[model samples]
Target: MSKIDPELKKKLLKESQAPFKGLRKIVWIAFSGSAFLGLFIMLAKIASGNELQLNNLLIQLCACIVFPTLLFVDRNKD
Candidate 1:
């Protein structure tokens, strides 16, 4: 029931990351790190009572969505 094509599999095994397992790990790390940075910055603003920035809001939104989605979606890739 395997879906892989044997010829393509051979070529992929000979090449770098032909199976693409590394991509999921890289994406997860990048997204999670970004989320942590955004959370830290947001806390800093709160601690100082700084004026709200619209771009910061956007960054938090991206981090929240991306991090959680990556967590669930990529859990099975390995």
Candidate 2:
């Protein structure tokens, strides 16, 4: 095999070891997922002809907030 240059190897290692390299991606996914789930629940309730309940809104709000917080905590623990 051809030998890799020392400088190139160092740069690659630095990027690979970045702890928060994909934090933005994770947060984005969490936000979108929470939003989609919340919408789905809302739509299901509408389809069933139930009046929108406070509990439904609370569930969605909690999901949107809790998931991101949990993700940040988990990432920082590493």
Candidate 3:
């Protein structure tokens, strides 16, 4: 078995990185993914002969890029 204690490894990982950095990153990725999916849905509707609103598609794309980055949120509790 490894000699290092589990708690020690957990503590070491916490100390080595800023807490909540990973959380914020994950949230951003999820937000972007959802936005991309929304845009894709609109495109699919158009392919089926349903009218796709260009503005809505553009808005979704912009939201995917802008929403996640809008937060100047950073892990300050290092």
Candidate 4:
């Protein structure tokens, strides 16, 4: 029978816990960027006196708010 070293076990455990940390950050950035962009576009439309689309505005607002909030929560989990 073989036994794992403590250091090696610790490293493996840490690595396994967040194997997709980088990927998760990338996805979070992409989604957050798009949410901000959508909010900006909606604001532009309002500034230009275009008819307001309530549903679209709400969706953008939620995305803009929710994504960052989710990221914050995810970070605190670590």
Q: Any idea what lDDT model 2 has?
A: 0.73
> Which numbered prediction scores highest in lDDT against the true structure?
4
- lDDT tens string, model 4, 1-78? 549998999978877987876677778878999999989988998999998879989999999998887676667353
Please write out the lDDT profile of model 1 over residues 1-78, one tens digit for every residue: 879999997777755544565676787888788888878788788789887777877878788788878777756544
Ranking by lDDT: 4, 1, 3, 2
* Model 2 misplacement above 4 A: 1-19, 53-78
- Candidate 3 CA-lDDT value: 0.76
Candidates 3 and 4 compared by lDDT, better number:
4
Of candidates 4 and 2, the better by TM-score: 4
The collision pairs in model 4 are: none
Per-model TM-score on C-alpha atoms = 0.55, 0.43, 0.55, 0.78
Instruction: Give the clash count for model 2.
Output: 0
Worst 10 residues of 1 by lDDT: 13-22
Count of residue pairs whose backbone atoms collide, per candidate:
0, 0, 0, 0
**TM-score of candidate 2 versus the correct structure, residues matched by position:** 0.43
Off by over 4 Å in 3: 1-19, 67-78
In candidate 1, position 65 carries an lDDT of 81
- Model 3 residue 22 CA deviation (Å) reads 1.2
